[model samples]
Target: MAKAVLLILLSAYVITEMPQASWANRPEEAPKEKVTNLQFYFHDTLSGKNPTAVRVAQAPDSDKSPTLFGATFMVDDPLTETPDPNSRLLGRAQGLYGSSGKQEIGLIMAMSFCFVDGPYKDSTISLVGKNPAMNPVREMPIVGGTGLFRMARGYAIAQTHWLDPTTGDAIVGYNVTVFQ
Candidate 1:
């Protein structure tokens, strides 16, 4: 009885100390994810920035919260408009307001970044930003992606790099950092 009890304790100790070798054979562990960072320079034309007409109300006490807006834009290196398709392509942004009352501080913007040239041609990155005015340096979330940027998630810092009040032209600098 004493020898049997000692053997049982020894087996328990060995089991506790041994690493499960079966784990190694249960399919090689997935490759570690690569976190990558990428930047994009683009120019946006704010002349056509308008609220959606579908939700337009004419009543005196109607809810005036504009839910959607159209943002027309063109992407460029050094953010300049050029005829070269390699350096420039048409882009669009749809702003979805998330603020209540007449305050214009909080707004969520989902921008679809389309690359018409280079290695990521025809790829789109879905970006989301909530409450731009709440922080001094607003951060936008990278929700998803398509094509070469598959399963992308990161943050983008959008600042009004330059705004031309005369033509309503804005050079928005998007320092986009994405991980696929």
Candidate 2:
């Protein structure tokens, strides 16, 4: 009888531990599905300085938050009329803003923006574009004397106006995911 009781207890223990063991043995599940391609509008707040980091906001009313994505400073391409050295081809931009005291001039790739999908909040949407390169130039007039100059610091710039690839109209933001 004692053996029978022990067997029953052991069976329950085994059942209880089985799930954990199975989970441990199995590969970890992928992270929750997130919005992949998101478009953000860019506004050149600094005409002379290159933007380094981008702060994403849920809406035009929301506060801007930092993100992993970035942009670069480049002249607008004459052919495409888009920012040159596109983010799709070059990758994310690198460099620090405010280093030259003068804001950098050029386009940057920004990842910060917020959108709503159904009833769920979708802040995972990232800007899709090419990164830029660092361009060192002499300081401009205003901030130049103060040891400040406009430097292409290689940062992502969010667009204040983005042409929807689908509709081809200027859009502030768009939804990339669906909520349950």
Candidate 3:
């Protein structure tokens, strides 16, 4: 199972397009190419007061902006060290997704992986994902970063590790490979 997951994550990264050169104007200082891999668990609670999941309407009328009537929310609370809920803190997944509505409206999202602990503590790895609402397996492009991950670029694969249908809570697995 682990091997299969790894293979899927790797392939996802290969399939996504690399960051466009126009996004950054600075020259490559250190190594032009470097790869870093990060595997962590994410817990998303959709039922909280400041819920991590929410539907956003572009206007008061739902029909006004169908494609823009999607949802935006956060994946901010989770255990990175272990799948267990009580594990040590790692960071947060600050994300937003949606179009107007439906499942196939050219879905996309910009998510920030903020690491509060570990070797990459206080750093952020930004990613842009397409087709975001299509279930458990999806690939996102690594655009840039801050702190230890400065000028980083790579891809991330997210898999549904577990979900609680009753509470709308979930545990997700993320495999991220970045070139700094």
Model 1, range 1-180, lDDT digits (tens) per residue?
999999999999999999876745666774556676655555544344441212222334333434222322222222322423245554434333333324444555555776666666677778766745434466789888888778988888866656565654545556777788
lDDT at residue 34 of model 2 (Cα atoms): 28
Model 3, range 96-165, lDDT digits (tens) per residue?
A: 6555345354457677889988888889999786745436687879999999889999888888778876
Error of 2 at 167 (Å): 31
Error of 1 at 55 (Å): 12
Clashes of each: 0, 26, 6
Candidate 2 wrong stretches, greater than 4 Å: 1-18, 22-24, 28-35, 47-96, 100-111, 116-180
Q: Candidate 3 regions off by >4 Å?
A: 1-32, 48-50, 54-69, 99-101, 104-107
Query: Would you estimate the TM-scores of all the predictions?
Result: 0.55, 0.25, 0.66
| TM-score ranking from best candidate downward | 3, 1, 2
- Report the number of the highest-lDDT candidate: 3
* C-alpha root-mean-square deviation, candidate 1: 7.9
lDDT of 2 by residue, 97-157 (tens): 2211113323233332232332213322233333221232211111100111112122222
lDDT of each: 0.56, 0.28, 0.73
On a 0 to 1 TM-score scale, where does candidate 3 land against the true structure? 0.66
Error of 3 at 177 (Å): 0.3
The alpha-carbon deviation from the true structure for residue 113 of candidate 2, after best TM-score superposition, in angstroms, is 3.1
